[model samples]
Target: MKDKKIERPIFPKKAIITAGMPYGNKDLHFGHVGGVFVHADTFARFLRDRIGNENVIFVSGTDCYGSPISASYLKLVEEGKYEGSIEEYVREYHEKQKEVLEKYEMSMNLYAASALDRAGEIHKGVSEEIFNKLYDNGYLAKASSPQFYDPDFKVFLNGRQVVGKCPIEGCSSDKGYADECDLGHQYMPDELIDPKSILSGKTPELRKVTNWYFKLEEYNNTLAERVDYLRANSNLRKNLLNTIEESLKPPVIFVKRKQLEGITDLEEKLPKHRTIDEPKKPSITFVFESLEDRDIARGVFDEVGVRFRTGKTLVPFRLSGNVEWGIPVPDKEELKALTFWVWPESLWAPISFTKTYLETIGKNPDQWTEWWHSEDSKVYQFIGEDNVYFYGIAEMAMFMALEGIKAGDKIDWDKINLPHLIANSHLLFMNKKASSSGAVKPPMARELLEYYTPEQLRMHFLSLGLSKGSVSFMPQVFMEEKDKQGPDTVLKDGNLLTNVFNRLVRSCFYTAQKHFNGTIPVGEISDSIMEESKEAILTYERHMYNHEFHSLIYVLDSYIRNMNKYWVNNMRVADTSDDNALRKQVLIDAFHAVRTVTTLIHPIAPKSCEKVREYLNVNENLWNWEYIFEPVYKFIVDQTMHKLKFLEPRVDFFEKHQSQISF
Candidate 1:
């Protein structure tokens, strides 16, 4: 321990952190902030300090265009609820989302909108670049797929305008639209159950429309290989890995046993396949080796009038639609009228936002390659569980495809650059699944700010254990009058700062001022204290490397409370014996613990930690990992000249929200 032989965790030299973009059609709900952005911010801030701040760039934006926004805008305009052009309406929410992020101290390098002003112009260029690269690499295909057409409205419906039961087997999604469900399950448009156009409130007919698609289905084997690569190379979340592997399955169709009863010739009529007919199960599964064979079987099934549902698997990822509000798809193969689909273009929006941020800072836009493609860099994308399909699978396949990676091609670990996805489970509202479109609507992100401080909410969100499973955001303030009687669970973690840690820090400062004329004695940290501090630092580092945030608060809780208890118990003994020597040693050991705690918690509660640093009268070197294990005297270049700032009586650095303060 004297020579410091312990190995430390290595972080990437340059990193990019991205949180999922909020759609421009609505203000951010609580899940957007508590479930994703706070977690993303904590890691980004840590990377900024672990490496240099300049090496980390965190960016996300308003997903400004798509069918959802179009549907929302038209509904509002017709209801006389809004009086503005679509651009103006989207901009309104974009500004609001930015404000909410700022109030919460998100620490984003840039928050640009996909379809607004300079960022929009840059995004359009980036989208075109991606499409051209994929086209030249032979991954783009123009296919005429069945689209929902509303006869009453005399128009083809966008994906979100059609609502039906999900066609993916084993999915319990509340609602499904065109080719995907609200829970991010993707399937064929033709397989949707009882489809109805929201435009006319009537059944829609299937109309063949030509649009561009990424050959996602053909890359099933290639994606399977990528899954193998990730399993060996990454420490990703179990749910995220399982979600991706689920989609790597081959094409499958399930038929209810009751519906196929007495149809003895069903197997002979369909294409060649393998059947798993378990008598105890309600349905029979038919698995095909390829999509072409499955499509043939599908036609035969429809001819015989047998009902079926598809299992979750990779399908042709549609890249273009006729939605006018979206960024225009690069006109290729004489297809001039299509626009990029919201899901595909938004996948690359982070790249566009990166370029825009670099340009605004007067750096070359192409410098994005260093952060995006270099071996020394890593991209960490944080998203909710519902988006694992889009971020973990679709985006990853498209990224590899853009790099000329195709089926059967070898992936060189040194050459290929793919993001490390961090998808958290749903953050429920009072233990119930909540969505803006659902019966239990989620509270807006800003609404919670009314009752709690931003730091309080940030601390609580980080401790919710969302990495392991879905967690309820049941703030007692939001509960019914009869149910609001217990000690508020939301305040449990924040009190470590506002009550315990705050008192210990104040005790150290006040004690130093009264006993040593405000100058802490220059001495070595006690061996016990140094050993414990090193252990805490290493544990915190490992948890961060794994992105296990809930465990971090657990570490802080123990370390902070122990330091407080040590001060309380020892100080009483020192006061009885009038032992100044023992008192000074206790102060020295406690201050070292204070420094380590302050540095470790900086990521989760940044503003308050900075205040803690200011009172210590130390420079930014206090946060440098090089001196992370050093005692307080190392930060003070002139120990004799340094005097800690005097703490005013009853002043708290980490204060409770005004609403939490009682008279």
Candidate 2:
């Protein structure tokens, strides 16, 4: 088939940009880059290049709520700085989050929701509105529950403050839950003997408080419907469906000896050894005549590291012994003593950050509601799978509790249901750089930025992000691959990372200094050849449009690689240094190829590309194939006189990292 030249269109007008909200509990790391931000920026930049700059807008922020931040706050209170106002506490963390994000070049247009910002008030108002809607619809109610309160601390205790022995027999940890032990033994908090509050080191008093609960059960059907719809079309939807299905199954019920009919069977059963083969051997029948003898069963099961549940109420219980933290319920006296509960919210630094983000931009409080509560907008949440429940489900419920009075006046809860995108990327653990919950290791994106250009990073993620699969941010693998090809390749023979970057640098260097005359100059171009390169550029654009980002990279890489190959194969002394016409043709073709590559790569590494563009002395706005193939590209080609640096091949680059990196 004859190679046909194609024309490329100018660009688009308007574009939307968004990145995943960061969680306040952990510091940012490389996994975040390979997983979220880099890809977001890549896509955003592409849109900016295609459409006008003013037409594109990207907005995102941190997720500063839920149990984790709340837990962090309680820890602060224990540290004895809990006396300040709530606003003071919220401010401190907001600043910290800003510092972290700013370091990574992850500049977003908005900040995450906070409890103290105008965004917080908006959130609170929306939450209240949603609650009121549900209430009027009979889907919310207040219920009284008996909870442990530490009188010594002068505070009501949530379940977490009560600590006790593991109900599981020989497992022997003080950390057991009411339903399950650390060893997986099942028991109840009520059955905990001599339970004490870890906070004050004293026995807790049982007190009753009225707590509000949204009728989640009522929306279970609605949630299930959305779940089914998502399962049909989305990858994450199917995984959640399986979990919900498993949760809906029948539960095992265990009964204790005290509930038995006046017969002591403790002596009838002999203590048994631990063996899966003889699960019911040695007559545990005496200690557990019926399932009701949960103490004996729980003890024996605890010894064996097994768990069972109560079948009666369809509830699962564990024997956990946690201390300090969680929202406290108000007592009957307090209900009458105060108009409202003056209880505090989270005091963690991130909780304070919401106001920091809003105030940083100097936006009015009402403005935040425009994005968060608007029904016309669709929310797409990108996060790791580990954060799905908190950022996705809990936040949705919280949002529902905060919707407005009327549908248009407030955030629409129904519109924001389970239908939102929970783009949970998979894990990419590193040996030296694996920053799970400890040590502020460098983010994968930052390290990668040092080695690979944005285009390379973008391509790698889109390749692995093939519908929610995990992608590692390891740099050694790519570096090592370049090393195996030897020293002459893009990467040096010894240092893989440096070599790979050098190759990208060479690409820019070659484009900047095309001539050996010390200055780049314009050359006349053939319309036919210019038109041929334009077709290739058009093909690249189409690939991006389809969201086939990997393919797009493949197309661009091949074009540039072949263009380099063409330079090497044809640069045979130019037949006596001055055969003017032939030399000019060679330069014109090289210019066209390099110019095309520069335009294509501008979005991925805008800063680096800008440098190359400056060196080439060309206007970036006129970067489309149409103008790029014009006399300007030839003019820049003619003025360059510096020695050209050949782009080294990729094969030799991998050998450099063979020893330092392992998968």
Best by lDDT: 1
List ranges where model 2 is wrong by over 4 Å.
1-26, 32-34, 50-57, 62-90, 112-126, 144-209, 231-378, 390-422, 426-428, 431-468, 471-560, 572-603, 616-663
Poorest 10 consecutive residues by lDDT, candidate 1: 406-415
Please give the CA lDDT of all the candidate structures: 0.90, 0.46
TM-score against native, each model: 0.98, 0.57
Candidate 1 global TM-score:
0.98
State the lDDT of candidate 2 residue by residue for 89-190, as single tens digits: 555655655565554444455555445455555444443344345556654456554557778888765434566665333454446532233323334445
The per-residue C-alpha lDDT of model 1 at residue 393 equals 78
With a 3 Å backbone cut-off (N, CA, C), the pairs that clash in candidate 1 are none
Model 1 regions more than 4 Å off? 1-6
